[model samples]
Target: MGNEDAVRDSLLIRGGFATLLSFLLGSTMWSATHPDDGSAQLVFLSSLAFGLVAAYGLTRPTMMSLPKRATWMLILTVLWAVLAFQEPTAHYMIVALFALYLYRLPLWWGVAATAVVMLLGSGIGVVVMGSDVSVVVGPVMAGLVAIAVAVIVEEVFMVGEDRRELIDELIFTRSQLAESEREAGVVAERQRVAHEIHDTVAQGLSSIQMLLYAAERDIPDDSPARDRIEVARKVAAENLRDTRAIIAALQPRALQGGTLADALRRLATASHENVPGLSVEVTVGHRSDSGALALGTLEVSLPIMVKSVLLRIAQSAMANVRHHSGATTAQITVVADLSAGLVEMEVIDDGRGFDVPGALVGASGRAQGGHIGLMTMRQRAASIGGTVEFGSAPGRGTVVRTSAPLEGHRLESQHP
Candidate 1:
């Protein structure tokens, strides 16, 4: 049962026990005072009646019509008070007063009932035991005390309930605010991706289109320049394919299946088809047991951002192979290991690698010429607490490996 139900049940049990005890005490007192009299018999029957009524009220279904229950309780309270005056015993009156409090009668009604019961009990005690002022005063004082205590307890309970409800409302509002912030972040990231594509891939494709059109106009139909023009056309076609793949990978509709493997495979397939004589191989580890990685472990933990970064890395790697590596084959491997809490990606190419030092120096010199792709890749990796390593020599092939911790271990452990 819920807390409220448990509390109500406790109240009902206590009320029932108090009622039975009062009935027994009152019956015993009447039996001793007037053993064979009609008045003693009447008191005995009234006590029994009060006990049965109190039990019925206490055991009644809580969810039943409140109005109906309240009406019946009020009727019983009146009968108990009237009968108590005739018997000169205050037990039924006490039970009736407790009923009013337990049922949560209105404040004005409670106050009025308390006053009436005190006056009635005091008058009865004064008339029946004329010599004892203590008898009248004590019962009156006890009735006032019971009413005051009941009111105080009810007010305190109500205040606590109000505070609890307020706390729950505040928690709900906070959750909604968090969700709104996340949606806003996603929108901002999408805009950033769009700007990047427009600045780089779109501009490059436009230039290639213009160059191919110019070459077509200048080269004769059967000349050596025509062959060169054909090669440029092929290069432009490859760049166009790369641009489309970049768009697809950036948007990443492939994440509908709930894994990055499908998107990466699509990227590798597109790369192989676009670059002649360059074979691309892809290997993806099992993701069935892999848990979701956190943003701290990978700057691109979000599916969209992850796809964008991977596409850029793949594009840069493929471009380097085609332009400088003289490679015939490339291997791409993606691994997601939840148990180890790591996601690893590696791109290896069997190409004629150049000196890493020379390339860095060259890249640094041309840094002003917008050689920002490699730098951005490094920055992206660092943002996610991951590391990017590039290995290459004058004769050895190039291998690029990136590893990021899954499950956001750092963030998870730090949360309070």
Candidate 2:
């Protein structure tokens, strides 16, 4: 049952018990004042004691184990049977018990218990009070009515619960569909940007470099202007390489036919080749020894867009290490923590680092030029519900840690 239904039932049961106890008290007082038999005082005292115990039982928590509730019900039945023998009016308490049973137990068990109570009450009325055989009729009708009411209540609550579940399911499905559409739009935009850079910026740089090289060759072999042309050609060549790298960053081709682990390994190899005297190592697996996930858990479970974001961040971090960090050895570590629903990549280098805050501030940070890459890494992580943290100081080693939620994760907070 829902929480509200359980609360309402609790109130109704307590109120019903109060009403029955009041009735029993009144009947006991009248019987005692009239002095019907020597047992009048005994019956009055017993009724008061039974009322107290039942009231205390009603105060227990509404939600109880089946065995405990059954035991309580059995005790109440025995007490009610004894009182019915002493006072005929006590037989009416059976109606209250029947309602309680119907509300708490299964339908068939409630009906059976109701039958037993009616039979026991009727026997007491006819034998102890000397009433007619028709004494069974009133209790039987009351029990049946209580059963019908209980069944109707159960049906109403079941329908409400089913409707609530359907509404919740629709809300969840709508949110997931919206996320899927947003992801698709982001991918399409990235591809368009990559294509634009390839067709315009990269192509223009290539033409400029080729023209400069040809012009340099035509000049006299030792002419002073020939050295200047060579320098310009080299500058154009470097710019062309930078442009191509930007295109690759916008849309990573390394992830096309490989998993994230393979992509990282290739990136490390390329970084080692690009920077002389720098050795880069890639490690992909769990961080702990116990409860290790499968080697390809991330590749099989993570979305392609998320994997691309991680690879781009790793590439940017590695670029910083090779170009600026001046480190001899670097480590690229990827850890999948299934329990936390997060995958983290850390790039650590024993290189000369700079002031993080100083490099991330306003125009001054932008003036540094290299800090632009750090901001780009942060933006990329934010786009995919991830975070990037830099740990470094001047003359100290640098560590870049990036984390993103795995597929199907619902993080409480997306930012740190």
Candidate number achieving the greatest lDDT relative to the actual structure: 2
User: Model 2: runs farther than 4 Å from truth?
Assistant: 1-5, 8-13, 24-35, 106-108, 129-133, 251-416
Q: What is each predicted model's overall lDDT from 0 to 1?
A: 0.61, 0.74
Instruction: Candidate 2: count the clashes.
Output: 0
122-201 per-residue lDDT for model 2 (tens digits):
77778876677568677778877888887897787777866675566455545644654575467657766866776788
Give the Cα-based TM-score of candidate 2 against the true structure.
0.57
- Give the per-residue lDDT of model 1 (tens digit) for 1-416: 43444565576555765666566546655643664555665656666776666667666646435576566566666656555655655433554455454534555566676677677666766676574878677766777777777678668767776666556544544564464346436634764685477467777776777887887888778887877777887887787777656644445354434346566667678777777688888776524344644322232233355444555566666677776678889988776555666667888999887666665554434332223334545555554566677889877898878776564332323311
The per-candidate count of clashes, in order, stands at: 0, 0
